[model samples]
Target: MLALLRPALWLGSCLRGYHMHAASTQQRGDTSLVLVDEARRFIQDCLLRVGVSPSKVRCISEFLVVADYRGNYGSGLNRLDYYLSDLQSGHAKVGAEPSIISETVSTAHVNGNSALGVFVGNFCMDLAVKKAEDSGIGFVVAQQSHDIGMASWFTFRAAGKGLAGIVMSNSAPTMMGPNSKSASIGSNCFAFCVKGEEYHFVLDMATSVKDIGAVEWAWANDEYIPHGWAANEGGLSTCFPSLALRTPLLFPAGGHKGYCLSAVIDILCGVLSGAQYATHITMDQNQPSNLGQVFIALDPEFFLPNFMERFDDFCGRIQNSQPADDSEPIRLPGELERMHMNYVEDLRAFAYPNSLLTKYKEVAERLCVKPIELAFDRCQSRKSF
Candidate 1:
């Protein structure tokens, strides 16, 4: 398994690098590091006040914290506002759990009832793992859920159980097909995990040339996007952040190749699940996204002998291979995330933007909870507070 973690470079463009700063507090300068435990408590407190069930809040908070720990900050606390908006707008219901609309020995179809997507994802993946444990494989599809933060997390869960896992989701239409200017399909994402004795391979990514969230982050941070990632209304590629956000016509990862893959994922996640598909799923408040997701788990013991041993051996060979660039070493797909977790553990605190921290304070005030105290530099003012 010469697992090519393949640096986020697709189609000879560094669109993925644009999000390397996902964990950055700002474009430049000193940043504040919020204590992780404090942040978690604050999030839980706020969500509970906003009508989220205790179990649901725990799951949601842990999910977001893990994302930040793994350096996937774009999907971490950065998405808090979006989640809050959905809950406040009556788009998501508290204490909603996925119900099995249909099920078999090795397959299940669930309806999330417009609840938080993390709950749906956890339920479907857990179901898959249970079925796989008993029947060698488990396949689950869920509809009517909100956004499932990162597709990789569910697969990683299965990997922890020594099973192969594949997960995918169809999102609201915020992406375009190859050579088209208008948004049509989603940045539809897929993730896979292969278990090994001591390590595992986890690959999660959007089929688009760049993640749409990258553009959203740029828009929020008042930054510019790189060329070739997005296009203007005229179908011409542009680098201006404002134009990209307004139009947001994303390019396919490898041109037509990515477009085809995106389409297939939508078929698996949206069309197959009988949920909203293509442009039918939109960001309009009046329209329900009815997002769909699929999770599959496979037990290696059912088919292969000495699977873990062989898998580990192959991974070792790839890791020991010489790199063309001496400065950079070859890494498996999940290696960087594991490394980031280790770094985060040592820090004990998570760094975020001052503006975002202030927003959290506002949310806390609105929820009538004690705000988390933030440490800031002298250049900032009391008037800002």
Candidate 2:
């Protein structure tokens, strides 16, 4: 679970115990290929230092690492700061647990009790998978949680077990409404996953054209964002990452379609679960998010008995289709994630940007946790993963 890795291993590919300071001094001009185990341990140790439950730390790490491995870099280590900030601000309660408030044969409502979102996500996803096995379908919702990291973490777990999975969560207002001057809507996100015989399809995305993390990355690298991605305080499309970050009026993906889709997810995760929706979920400013979420699992065994065969047929046809550009073959939803997984496994490590690595190292220095092992010299590896 990345900004940890899906194929994380404790010992392999490179030397260990190498600290950031030992590698570089002032200019963070290049990336590092870090041992997966070292990175995972670093995240856990940092969270532990911040008072997270030992057992719950694994879930949070899994969420982050998976996102990074799946190419959702914005949700990966790029987001570690958000979690640490919450704990440091005393807004996120340490070691809090979720409780089920009500349930039926195929549905349940939960109260996260202000726990870190990953803990809540783990509990709810487990319940959903179990219920789907027993009843053919499971639908669970929760309120009072924090950020759940990535929706793919929940769906990936279920799809890996041969079930279809769906997840959605509401968020702070980070997108703009049509004609609005500043951000006035949430970037509500959702993910869907399903497994076939030889493939699994995963779709994880924000309703907005892009998420805040993507914007942050562009800004950090001193690059202009793509046109149509977001707007500035003046409600005009702007390429300036700093301006976009300042006002944060992300353009809805596909215009009205994206807006409506986010609204629908908000109703499911926020309204139904009694959690704050849209603007009610505050941005930064040291306040608990109290976010709402929905997790669902459906068993193929109970329906579509030829599910795998049908999926193969569908894939074969797509695979055979001719591409307009010979170099750019069509790809399925989770293909990039699978490719990243294999790339890391082959190298036995994860690649990280110098900017992010510097921040992570600073975190370790500040918290007194062990530094995550990393390699900066070109002799260590020929290229970034």
Kindly report which residue pairs in candidate 2 clash with one another: 1-64, 1-65, 1-66, 2-64, 2-65, 2-66, 3-64, 3-77, 4-65
Q: Candidate 1: how large is its RMSD? A: 6.6
**What TM-score would you give candidate 2 relative to the actual structure?**
0.87
- Point out where model 2 deviates above 4 Å: 1-29, 377-385
- In the range 132-237, model 2's lDDT, one tens digit per residue, is 9999999999999888877888887788778999999998888877666666568888999987887667888899988887887665444567778888888889
Which window of 10 residues has the lowest lDDT sum in candidate 1? 1-10
Per-model TM against the reference: 0.88, 0.87
Residue-wise lDDT of candidate 1 within 1-385, one digit each (tens)?
0011111111001322553333342233323556677778888888888888887889899988888777677788878777887887767767677899999999999998887888889899999999999999999999997899877889878988989999999987767776577889888989999977676788888888777777765555445677878888787888776787676688888888988998999998899998898888868654444898999999998998798898889989999899999988898887777766665565555656556677778888888998876533321432322
List lDDT for all candidates, in order.
0.77, 0.77
Give every collision pair in model 1. Answer: none
lDDT of 2 at 380: 40
Span of 10 residues, lowest total lDDT, candidate 2: 10-19
